[model samples]
Target chain A: MMLNLFHLTVLSFISSLKEETLPVAEFVNKSVKWITEKFSWFFDPIKNDFGDKLEDFADMLAEIPPSIVIVLVVLIAFFITGKKFGLATFSLVGLLFIYNQQLWEELMLTFTLVLVASLISVIVGIPVGILMSKSNLAENIIKPILDFMQTMPAFVYLIPAVAFFGIGMVPGVFASFIFATPPVVRFTNLGIRQVSKELVEASDAFGTTGSQKLFKVELPMAKTTIMAGVNQTVMLSLSMVVIASMIGAPGLGREVLSALQRANAGTGFVAGLGIVILAIIIDRITQNLNKESA
Target chain B: MPVIKVNNLSKIFGKKTKEAQKLLDEGLKKEEILEKTGCTVGVNRASFEVEEGEVFVIMGLSGSGKSTLVRLLNRLIEPTEGDVEIDNENLAKMNKDDLRKVRREKMSMVFQKFALFPFKTVLENTEFGLEVQGINKEERSKKAKEALELVGLGSFIEQYPSQLSGGMQQRVGLARALANDPEVLLMDEAFSALDPLIRKDMQDELLDLQEKMQKTIIFITHDLDEALRIGDRIALMKDGSIVQIGSPEEILINPANDYVEKFVEDVDRSKVLTAENIMKRPETVDIDKHGPRVALERIREQGLSSIYVVDRSRNLKGYVTADDVSDAKKQEKKDLKEILRTDMPTVEKDTSIQEIFDIIHDASVPVAVVEDGKLRGIIVRGAVIAALANGNEVNGDDA
Candidate 1:
């Protein structure tokens, strides 16, 4: 926001001369293009190998019989929600409804996408969170970057993501990753810091090494909060599906995007309904998982 | 020998510690040091030794640095100056690994808030210290279970800390520290969070554990009664510096300063007072050396209701009431031991005044303070009441 205001002042002064504007957009575009060119080595494997593996995982899930998948999901939901079966019933009916609508393939793809993005977010975010908690300088440096990642339009990440990975699920995963990561990082940091000072002292008093302390005390204590963040990340990734569809990412999001272009409200609503079913099932399951851990 | 020794330790909680420490050494007070150098002295030139198998309690009011001082012993809060030697190894000079070795094998702390890991079961919490030392799973679990049972929580091993009461949780905390079998146990207000009745029980339990384990313990508390009840020696602190370090009786009887005086002024002395303090040097006649007539004359001369009769070695045979002795004398009895009655209540010298009060109230004769069957002194009802009333032992020793 501060950058925007600075650019705005500069733009206003520059605009007094006719059809001229600040070169901030050009600068960002050139910088990203330069990064893409210079760091092709870094971006290529992620685009190719990781993207293909994700696709295969999604395909493998899609190939499973709908009845079997529904039963398994329902069983997990039943047990995880403490066996009363409210969420289990929801999962049973919701999966059946999506199957009945012939949107099973799209649902699997969206589930894979959300799960993969959230997994990536966790793997990267937790350590970053730990670093931020451990050092004041790291916290100060990363907090503003997190603010930018969270507040910037999700659509803006697509350009560079597509530039690096081309149009596919990979860039979609990339955009969802950037958008969904902050909460995990933030909540992880909050969770660790929120551990009572006495608890920290108690662990230290026992002479636990840094890693031992983190895993045995801090991480386990922070699990619930981190799970809360992960749950948010999953839901946020689901929210990004439609936006992700604009970059040729497959799933129910594609259905939603195509339905929008063709002005097919009935199909769009059905696809939107598919996304909602997946979201509610995933959300309840993750939340119940968190409760179980707690 | 001292198990742990802290020499001229200071912890200044700011960037300008060198200047603050210098100011502190120059005898500037905590506030003055803070004002001059923008550094708060958390512990100021504190030094004390904890003897092996001793319960050394550091007592102070809130913000008086007792807590800070305890942490400094374990290097939990780094001292800005000086050294803490645990078994001749300097804690401040050690690397991370060596310091950890000291912490894991030499000492462990029990936190005031009962800082059991909420996610861990009681067994896991207790297992923590041993687990950190890379003990085998079987051994660590066995030790942890034993430690839990030592604190009387054997059945609750599978239960999480939240499921336990505050007292039980503190037990788990104590068990955790004990599981490591460290020579020194640092308890930072370990029982201050419990209800009064439970606190008393825990204090008794700790005393029991201390007796059994014989671990050198550094206990921190703001409560003087708790300190007096548990501490073998007490260090009285004021504003980040120790004012006095002495036994509970010494601190109570002769406070080092007005602060120490004020701190202990409101204490209920009945708790610290023992039979030894109030016991009078009773008049007694040796049965082997004196007859019933001598016992009767002595009782009459002392204007006493009774006189205790003893053997030649002063082993209490029993007390003889004046009437009985006179009756014996009238009968021309030669042995005072024949008329002596053994029904008078006998108590140990270390027995607290409260216990003595109950024992002496129903007894007709003075309560005999006996040690190994030998009479040490006698606690009469008058002397017991005088000690309670004056909050100090009277001139009972004068006799």
Candidate 2:
């Protein structure tokens, strides 16, 4: 009897709120059409300019000879983080291994994607975070939006991104950018908010202007935390590479995706191994930089 | 003229400050005003003048508005209602730029927490004010180094604040303020966070620096002893209002109410009352006057065992005991100088009564309160005991 009642209640509820009667798809389509038709000028320039820049950077990274790139990376690792010979050697060996696997160009493409996405994320995130830190109203409004962006499935964003940017590297970047921005923003806000009240009072007492206090005291002190956020953004960007490749973004992700479809276990293993090595190299370099700054 | 003058300064810490201020003007107490308007009165109609080169102390318990008053003096915390004039220029009317300029040029502050920028080296912190003033690097660095040396932190200039001890960090904080060469200094519980020994040392160091710098200073503290030890005059706050303002001795001898009396009840009067506060007029005979016979006559007339012997210019030569005077008279001594005992215990007018205990313990004659080479007054053992026993009732006759 109870089961029959439950079924009846469900039937009534479903009949009252029929899926076909809902205007969700129609509303979304109309909004999308209107945005594209009316505001294409606004978005198209950004999409074209940013997309071209990303592709150019990726091509540059890919065209560089493997040996020269390896030399540069090792020198950078050694010089920026003095006495890190072990890290430099590891980076060198890791790059050589990726080259041996014949995945050098794919690695470079993945590197470029992560670099560009992380750069965009940091550029946009810091000021937003600072705004969030400064105003409770901004923080309250932005927090849930950030949560929505972070929590929404990466694939769900990809659909809309492809609709706006078409299936290509730009849409892939747009998707990855949505997926990776929250950490930097959240961390920057947290870092600034966590500055000791006494220190802020001291700054005010010394007659520091608002901007001077931010640049001289707050930002410098919050550097480690903000860098941690940057590190997270980079990793998140890397994680989106495989997903981004489904939209024809070229990288180790493409290699892995093609290998998955072809059922080529060896190719998949090699591509996956290449990705891990690349991730390790980037992670170690950033972690070392953070430690040095600290 | 006073370097800093505050008139009717009040700060209410809530949105209903205007309402609370109205209640305050109508003579509502802090708690009553809070009940009426949900506003916490941080400072209530505080008014005081700080003379140039004076260490004017503001003292109260944790919530009594002492800190708020000091911050208001610098306009660090904007007052709800008041006029603060620094060197006769009204700070309340200054614009942002002018206020910043005043902060950089006329007034500097040291915090209780030492408020050193954690990321900055001691040298960098010391140079902060000068940097804000846009001084050239070479000149600012030279000035900063001098200030650091003045605070005895010259050696740790290269170290970050976290590397230093609390007291040392506070000294760096002081150096940071001093480096600005500000005409006035506001110290907010600057040594309250230190160990007792370190706090005493800092207090002494501040007094020493005060001697050399002679800047107008407004010092905030919760410790009464500290207020008495360092302040030229002290204003005691209670429930967001100043209840009393006087020198330490005046506060001790004549508290304004029962609250102040109870506040000072446990204080060691011997430490707070100085020779200047307790000294009395002394009977004396001039050394170059007549002879030992005259000295004997003066002692006998005063019914005293001994009399201080001063030259005609009132410069204390020494003292002569009645026995020595008689011995001189019997020997027919022509000069009273021969009988004068130059070894009598003497103290400066600024010396604390606690310091005179040992000097007065075995002395037959009263301790001469001297400033430079001349005698100002004398301190007797009985007077010290009377002042210590009943701090408020101490009168001129007892001293």
Highest DockQ scorer? 1
* Model 2: colliding residue pairs: none
Cα shift from native, residue B89, model 1 (Å): 1.2
- Candidate 2 lDDT (Cα, 0 to 1): 0.88
Residues forming the 10-long window of minimal summed lDDT in candidate 2 chain B: B390-399
- Model 1 Cα interface RMS deviation (Å): 0.6
Predictions' DockQ, in order: 0.71, 0.53
Candidate 1 residues lying further than 4 Å off, grouped into runs, are A1-22, B279-348, B355-386, B392-399
C-alpha positional error of residue B131 in candidate 2 after TM-score superposition, expressed in Å: 1.9
* TM agreement with the true structure for every prediction: 0.87, 0.88
lDDT of 1 by residue, B317-349 (tens): 988888888888889889876777888799987
Best by lDDT: 1
lDDT of 2 by residue, B285-305 (tens): 877776888888888898999
- Judge candidate 1 against the unseen true structure and give its global Cα lDDT, from 0 to 1: 0.90
